[model samples]
Target: MRVSREQVTANREQIVVNAAEQFRRRGFGDVTIADVMKAAGLTHGGFYGYFDSKQALEAAVCERGLAESVAAVDAVRDGEGGEGTAAEAPLRRFVDDYVSARHRDAPEEGCTVAALACDAGRSGPELQQLFVSGITGMAGSLAGLRGQGSAEPAEDGGPDFATLSTMVGAVILSRAVAAADPELSERILAAARERASAPVE
Candidate 1:
């Protein structure tokens, strides 16, 4: 029985979703096509029919995961009517939620940017472009909420780099120290929260 085109599309989508979760949990270098296929409940042989290579699947994952991450952040911002005080602003609230232990403890369900940053730096050109474009999308979404809506960020995505850097860096460090020094992890998160929560002059 041949599968319909719609089924194939659905299967590919499922594989990308499963791959995204597994990649976040296990990192990009560790996950295999078989792992993603198994997670998707599909046979391993069917992997190639869906993706040319692991890198291809990674490109799909990057697109889906980064868009989802951006949507999550935008939801946090848009949910508050986009009209809050500095302390209650979208950027501040996003930082509070993003830097919290809840996000730090749950890599599989957390930010794709932090989850994939380690691998993107050394990826091939195609994957690198995907990361570059996707990151800019995420950063642009955050920058729009950074209280500089009227001002356009640089063409190279320099605006709000500190905000994204602090969020991603703090989460990375907190996760790194979480197993060895949990208290220090909390402090790291707190510091980021405080920094982002500071009032704009």
Candidate 2:
């Protein structure tokens, strides 16, 4: 039977979502089209119907994950407000969520930057571009938060690049060393949480 266009779109989105989860959990090189299809509960042959190539699927995945990450950060903005350290409460909550043991152990649901930046660097231009856009969106959402309180925007009006770097880098380092030294992993998150959530100067 022929499938409806809506069904096809839903199926394609399902495949991308599953692929994103699997790729984040297993890494790009370790995942395959068949694996993504299987994770999506669709037949392997149907993969070509949705995407032209694994890279295409990855681009879609990155798009979805990055958008969600930015949205998650944007959601925190509604919670902004308090005096003193309390003023940083919203971003602090976000930082804690991003740099926690739960996030470290759950790559499939974590930040795309932390999970796939290294792979994207080698994956080719299209994927790299998606990473760039995604990272920019993330930073934009974060930059929006700074505008909420007394902290004025930097001349560039960009996200606090240092804090963004620390947040992503901390997760990456913590995950990288997690298998070898669990203590270090927790400490890494702790240090990053402190820095990433600190009140702006």
Candidate 3:
């Protein structure tokens, strides 16, 4: 059966979206093309029509995952109510959302960086580059938030890389620690949020 170009485009996007969610929920190594195709409600044989190889599908998934994450950060940084919302409001929203237990428990819907950075570390260069770009972009957004509220010229006049790292690290650690020590997990998140909100020197 011949698929219309519009339907083909939609099908391809569906596969990538489903694959991204699966990769975020499970590690990249754990999700197979069959699993992704099944999740997308498509036949396994049709997978090759959209992607030349699993690696190509993975690259597509990586880009989609990173795009989802980047969009979330952008929404927070730009504020939902358009201009005039307090500059600090969006940053606060991001820190709170990013470090919350909800985010920790919901890998499929959360930041890809927190969900898959460790997995990406061992993946191909293209995927790793996507991870790096996602992290860098996120940090840059947070740094811009920090700069708006700082009295000084923002030190080197860039984003606060440490705070952004701390937020991402805290989410990963919190998820790891949550299964064993719930209190500690919450404490970790709280500390990261507090530290992120603190005035930069």
Candidate 4:
């Protein structure tokens, strides 16, 4: 029987969402189209009905993950009074939650930047573009946290690309280190939060 248009659309979205999470958890190179289709509860034969190819789907998944990451940061900022400057409370919360064992153990739901950055180097141009946009969005979110009189230059002096890269790298490395030593993980998390909340000197 032919499936309804709505069902097809829903199925496609399900595939993308599942693929995004899987890619985030297992790196883009490690996940197969069949794996994504199976996780989405659909047959592999029907994969092309949704995506032209796995590359196409990977691009879609990257976009989806990027949006989700930005949304998470947005949620945190919204809860904290929309103040543009990574202050103590929100920054602390982000560092604690992001570097915790929980985030490390759950790669599928973790931050895409930390989960996929290494693999992104091998991705196609389309996927690379998605990473670029995602990084830009993340930097924008971080830049918003600076206070009014900080006198930091926007986009550069502020928590721009380099700063954001450091933050993501720190979280990723902390998670890796945490796997062997719980105490080290806790220390890394605390140190990251302290640094994130500290004023620029």
Candidate 5:
């Protein structure tokens, strides 16, 4: 009953994808390897076949989540008439998606940085590095929207890191009280959008 290499790769990817979504929904400490394995439709005994340990799986999950987030931003940029399109078009798309109600309600498929930042502080270095890379990628994406080749300083004094942090922080705050304070949640997103879209000063 040996599996083919293709199937094995699919299984491993499935495990990572599912684990990433679950980790974003539930903190790392709250999720167990057995739980992830069961959710992935594989037996607990087979978990080790794909990942050496839960920590390794966490790292993989973080990697996958971060890649997806950056890809999402890149897709928006690519759609906006290649590199010559107005930077504001991609920037608006990024802000809209980042603070949207759909994103706020969908933790399993949303940005991992906003979903798992608190947990990342207590996690191992692998997950921490993944978080840092994701944040940097996001900042770079926003910087690109400004026609900058890198996340270097803008002549207008707008910092990409500041924009990235503000967006992530807004989402975090929006989600924190979304259930009990729906109006505040909506306002949070709207306010963040307005601020993010304003001219960087």
Candidate 6:
């Protein structure tokens, strides 16, 4: 039977969403189109109707994943109330949550920015662009947290690139290391959080 346009659109979106989750959980190279179709509850034969190839799907998934990651950060920021601006609150929460063992064990719901970066580096140019954009967006979110209490000019400065890089790196490393030694993970996570939450001066 022929599917309605709306149904096709919905199915395509569902496929992308499912693919994003799977990709985040199992890396891009590790997941096949058949796996994605299975996760989306669609037949493998129907994959072509929605995407030209796995690369196309990867691009779409990257966009969806990045969007979800941004939303998660926004939710944490929103939960903080107006006591602080969107930029700082979210980054603080992100730093805390990202480095935790909870995030390490639950790859399906973890930060897409960190989960997909390594895989994206080996993907096609289009996929790399998506990854780059996602990283830029994440950095912008973190930079928003700076100077909330200080009288310093907002435009004059923000979280340095090195600082943000260290934060993200620390989370990824802590999670990886935590798998082998729980205490080491906790120590690294604590140090990373302290650095992220430290004063601008």
Q: Which candidate gets the maximum lDDT versus the true structure?
A: 2
- For candidate 2, write residues 72-91 as lDDT tens digits: 88877776322225545566
Candidate 4 has its poorest 10 consecutive residues by lDDT at: 146-155
Candidate 5 Cα misplacement greater than 4 A, ranges: 80-88, 148-159
lDDT of 1: 0.79
| lDDT for 126 (candidate 4) | 77
Model 5 Cα lDDT, one tens digit per residue, 9-90: 9999888878888898988988898888888899989999998889888887788788877887777767742332454466
Residue lDDT tens for model 6, 84-173: 345454455556676566776677777777787788778778778876777766655556655333322224464345445666677677
C-alpha lDDT score of every prediction, in listed order: 0.79, 0.82, 0.80, 0.73, 0.79, 0.71
What TM-score do all the candidates reach, one by one? Answer: 0.87, 0.89, 0.90, 0.84, 0.87, 0.83
Q: Which of 1 and 6 is the better model by TM-score? A: 1
Q: Runs in model 6 with CA error above 4 Å? A: 74-91, 149-160
**lDDT-sorted candidate list, best first:** 2, 3, 1, 5, 4, 6
Q: Kindly report which residue pairs in candidate 5 clash with one another.
A: none
Candidate scoring better on TM-score of 4 and 6: 4
Candidate 3, residue 48: how far the Cα is off, in Å: 0.8
- Candidate 5: C-alpha lDDT: 0.79
Worst 10 residues of 5 by lDDT: 148-157
RMSD, every candidate, angstroms: 3.6, 3.1, 2.7, 3.5, 3.7, 3.5
Better of 3 and 6 by lDDT: 3
Candidate 3 collision pairs = 143-159
